[model samples]
Target chain A: MTTTTTTATAPPTRPVVSRPQERPFGLIRHSLALGRRSLIKTLRTPEQLLDVTLQPIIFTLVYVYLLGGAVSGSTQDYVQFLLPAILVQTVLFGGMATGVNLNTDIGKGVFDRFRSLPIGRSAPLIGSVLGDLIRYVVATVSLLTTGFVLGFRVQTGFLSALLACVLTIVFAFCLSWIFVLVGMLVREPGGVQGIAFLVLFPLTFGTSMITPKETLPGWLQTWVEVNPVSHAMEASRALMVGGSAGTHIAWSLGFSVLVLAVFAPLAVRAYRRRT
Target chain B: MTFAFEAEGLVKRFGKTTALDGIDLAGRQGSVLGVLGPNGAGKTTAVRILATLLRPDAGRATVGGLDVVRQAGKVRRLIGLTGQYASVDEDLTGTENLVLIGQLLDLRRTDARARAKELLNDFGLAEAADRPAKTYSGGMRRRLDLAASLVGRPDVIYLDEPTTGLDPVKRDDVWTIIRSLVGDGVTVLLTTQYLEEADALADDISVIDHGKVIANGSPAELKRVVGGQTVLARPADPARLDDAAAVLAAVAGRPADSPTRGVVAVPVSGDAAFTEIVRRLADAGIAVTELSLRLPSLDEVFFTLTGRHTTEEAA
Candidate 1:
């Protein structure tokens, strides 16, 4: 067969171009991006959502059914007492997510990347702490909805209930700063968990989550009264149960701010060292 | 040419261990400086300091005339860094990873997305742009990591073993990207354990050992330090190998070593020695099959300066 060969010529394609734009550097923008990325991860990881939602519901149900009659006089009374405690317990435990997620990111070399970036120094710490607020809100709403479904009523008005919810979330949000510091100080995820538990267990269990501090032994009563978490739980419970707000609320708000003020800087300092 | 980066007596210590021992390095604008060393040789430490991720305990470093320690924010604005491994958020898609960096760099949302798209296309990651980085292959993840660093169009890029785990082909792809980066007037400080990588990509190389720079020069200049032309001779017949060896030995006046099954190697002083050896071998009717003179490879230079073979010392 006779054939003729011809070279194929094609028209030139447009050159690939990138139009660069100037970027501004500020704390707010950096923190917002850091927070946005973290929230996006939470959206992708449903398991993270499940932990905050499922754990509180199950823990509240089990505690009310098993320990209600023994701990309090009646199931309804126990429900009233248990709901606020569950709020504090669930949200405080949920704060562990901050440390766990921070440890995971650091272990995976994510923080190393953050270190190389030209972003605000406190962005990651603030972002992760703020990100855990989403988890806290989820747990709070789940517990409150479950309590309402279980025939537990909030004697406080709607505004008070909303305010109580805000206080609980804010308390948990501040608590996360401590765990964020723990996460930065410890290199391993398990170490973060251990340290978080060591600090949280005493602050939580030594308080009056189920029984009133008045019912405890003299020394134990004093310990519970002095426990910052107990004051937070008591203030939240009193506010939700139609009791008059007192020094407990002031102390809780003051203590939450104090913890945040102390730990936020510590966490930021540790994060700087870590990166 | 202006120095894109100049570090004078950069010293860094972690606890009592000195990670960098007064390292002095400079890279010209639009050129590549490859820091070659084994593991624990302080290559990464130097890159970290230059990238503004770590502060030097002594001396000073500057990128684009911004001090790495005192003016770290300005230095950071002028540089991008891709570390030994991919450090993007795996939970996010490749596009999201780049976009997040763009946003962190303070790009508006629209600008960030546009920059992300541009980088994804430039890095050959457009097809997997929507896929989470965890799903990407090692090479793709590395490319995405590089793309994320370029979101700000940094003037100086620090690549710390950018091809550490990549296969040869993938490594070549990265090398191509690095070449294009330098072609775009971007300075690169590359750290690598692969000597051939330095020989291929570096405008100048510094070989560090035990936290100190033991040698620094262009690849050709460094290779010349371990002087002598390598003479390779192959005999026409396997049985005549000894004759060829004797010829090489007699002409060179040094012991000839057999590198292969039938090839003898001798160090020649110059081209005259090479011609003389070839003449001697031809006169003996040895029918020399192969004769060539080669300058020492970077491996030989590394061995001569460090007193250890690259491969052996690397292990």
Candidate 2:
């Protein structure tokens, strides 16, 4: 068979097309661009906002009014105690959205488009985690605003409160890598949701996220005290309210780093193979 | 001659099923090499491998002379791919999808925007440029997907059954766009289970079956391999069918196969055979409602090579 390149060699029929030079930091740049796309998706589909915007409000109300007295003896006293836990729970839930959205994106072949592009291999996952951080920020703010309205105050001052929010969001971003791995491994979006809920339910509720670890039964207390959610709750509590912050902060940061070190590479590997 | 796309002895397996078994293909620069296959025949598998979307188990392939495995990043820069499913973001507007791809391709922000608008207009999607792709009809979604792939204007394109779910008119639109891309000297590797699509688009064709290439040639060359064409005549009077069949058989020096009522089809070697059959029918005093010479279609070529017909679903 005659190759068309023969003609080009002879007479050069077509103009020479110059290719775009690869950017030095194309991975980070592409990730930011994709992250912006994901954020716009959240904006256009406002129902995705419900978890951050509405979940905290309703959950805060339920904990303060219905279960507040039973847990902390009074609604006024419980708001300060319950607010940080609620924020942790909210960010945790927000973090799981990463896995679900990633799974759905894979199912719908969006990543196929990304995979074919000359972009970074891990850009989609990194971009997704970054975009979902917006959800975490919204949840943190909503929880704090609702808590303050319900008589909660940060005893440790404004900087501490800001630190607490940043710490929690960072921890949530790290925790999303675990769910990102789950999302990449799961067969379907629904399956990701199911597995995420299964893994998260016991970790969040059994910890000091709502009721104190001291009140739990002896055997369950062991698991609750060691749970990463409890450590995050304690870190945020230490920063937002007055407490010994160093140990809890260390543990939360340590857990975040460990989870990232483990799951981030695994998720990236799975993504490369699966896509 | 430098091949824009080339694959040799490519083998891929998913569990126990070999999706591709030692398949080989080559497409010259600025030409379309159609990989036509039935479902489970590894058309998509081959395209995916060449597109740098999958790894071949045992073969080496190259695009623009860059190794697909080792020089994948360079290969990606030189090729654009459109899969069977529309890969544009459903949540984003058509403009957003194209712009995002442009940005990912490392275009300047303003340049990307300009290119997106130009593509939207070229694809006849300018009116719906700001609307989310979810709202697009199947054809529009496909057009947007194709438009997204062109944002980089790569040297080679891999289209994996791009018109699978599109209506006839939409498929034709995609065909036109593909032709224009080739007209601009873009080499294309098109995979399709549809015989007619390959016939319409490909300069050269490879027929794959059960993960192997059963045949490879230009469309006319492949049709010749199946056999010669046939001359058919339908008698005006049903009672004269035998007479027309006898005349066709006498001139063509073969048995006339009557597949339908009042119609006789005789295999003819060339135009001379056609002329002799017409003269003989006229001498036999047979009045026919229709008379024509029909070349064997890709369908017949496939049937001759493989015992089974192509279907939408894979085995």
Candidate 3:
């Protein structure tokens, strides 16, 4: 009897504190916090890491051993050539996880909760984009480690090789916004995955990944020349191996800036309008 | 007095179907305003508009004197939303979900953690705080969802059918939580398909149907809107039904209508009249096989208002 009375009389705990005043730079802060959530969620589900970690290593082994002799005279030369394209290719596909995860997220009610919060509208989108930087880093490190193990050497210094990794990561980060847009409009995560395949396969394979551009048909060579993915691959290759990298670096940076400018706004707009 | 939140002449359409048709709603500060309706009666569309999750095609809505569309960010500071689906992140732990919401509200990391702990303890989730929300029972996930909404101490909160699909015991827990939130003087906009829930928790109830509010009043007033209750009496013999109707009419202060040949029912003002019917039927020597006073269910109310059976509402 006394227990019922005691329980009824006890006050409910509401530790919620109000900070009605708007904070400056809230975009950066909120994005960072949401990004932390993505990181934690990813860590808890280690299988999600298979795309970044496992894919790169497997692709490197297959290409360097299977196609290495056919593409180049020796497995040694092919491994060096394949490593740069493989890193860029892996991270570019790694960007798909961002969209697929987001598509799955929006299908649930979590995005509705985020939308109702006081954070900046684009914070969740940008935060997931930032949080996925881990995937790119993992792919780069895994691919490079596998490359070194197979006797593939970077002729350029360590700093230039590091710059090449940075370039590919930045390009992938910017490229992810397009997938983010797809995630927002598409009804299903499977649809996002489908579009990712439709977009990525041609873009990655159409590049001079396995063979030299000069050996391909004239029309194909022209595409490899203009393709942004090819620019990123060529930029990384030139940076890791000794070459005049200024033009390729400029084209890669320019493509990253262009994609970010066009797709970031579109993705954010789609998110706000999705409901 | 200015409302804690208000929506006026709000219209929203998805393709050719209008989800909300020029509806208006308002809730007083520190009180519960129940938006009672069946499924797809525009209750959720209305809540989403007020929560600033969905923009209305027409009309202006405000929360704490700020426009929902123009000043959405400011309105967000004053409001929290809980939907029928648990909105807490399934991948995150209970503590992590609440803490993330806290951090989004700009609380320092330490403060966010402390607040998350407090909420988890209060919601009876402290024991499972470290576990991912996916591992939580349905009730535990709902608690964490509610906890996530409360992390910022919003002045107004929108609960969109919060207890839908819950067991009775879990529902009672949610009701208790809602009552305590009201006790803390937070304004609430609670939508539910259950009329009893609205009557029990709402200071004012707005009865809506097909995207329009058909009635609005305190629970008692809304109850009376559909003629309150009925003094239903069934005759032991079909031949004696006329006498039963007369007895019911005399006691209920209105002419009784025979819904079926075997029974006569007349809407009564209160339960006190039910006792009068019992007394008068005995005086008249009328044999009633069944006699009772019954309150109107939501289906009955909708039937009375629109002359439409709520067959789909039940679905």
Which has the greatest lDDT? 3
Clashing residue pairs in candidate 1, if any? none
Docking quality band of candidate 2, CAPRI definitions: acceptable
Candidate 2 lDDT, A20-76, residue by residue in tens: 556678988899999999999998998897878888999999878997899889998
For residues B1-315, could you state the per-residue lDDT of candidate 1 as single tens digits? 689899999888888888888999899888899998878889988888898878888989998777888888767767888988788889999988988888777677787888889889889999999999999999998999888888887888899999999999999999999998887778899998876788789999898876789988897776555445668888879899999989888877777766669888766666788888888887999987888887544455555676665566532
Cα lDDT tens digits for candidate 2, B281-303: 78878878899987644444465
Candidate 2 chain B lDDT trough over 10 residues, lowest sum? B304-313
- Per residue, candidate 3 scores C-alpha lDDT tens digits across A207-247 of 99878888899999999999988888898899898778888
TM-score of chain A of each: 0.88, 0.91, 0.92
For model 2, the stretches where C-alpha displacement exceeds 4 angstroms are A1-18, B227-297, B311-314
Q: In candidate 3, which residue ranges exceed 4 Å CA deviation?
A: A1-20, B227-268, B272-295, B312-315
Whole-model lDDT for model 1 versus the true structure? 0.82
Worst 10-residue stretch by lDDT in candidate 3 chain B? B306-315
Rate residue A81 of model 2 by lDDT: 90
Q: Given the true complex, what DockQ would model 2 score? A: 0.45
The DockQ ranking, best first, is 2, 3, 1
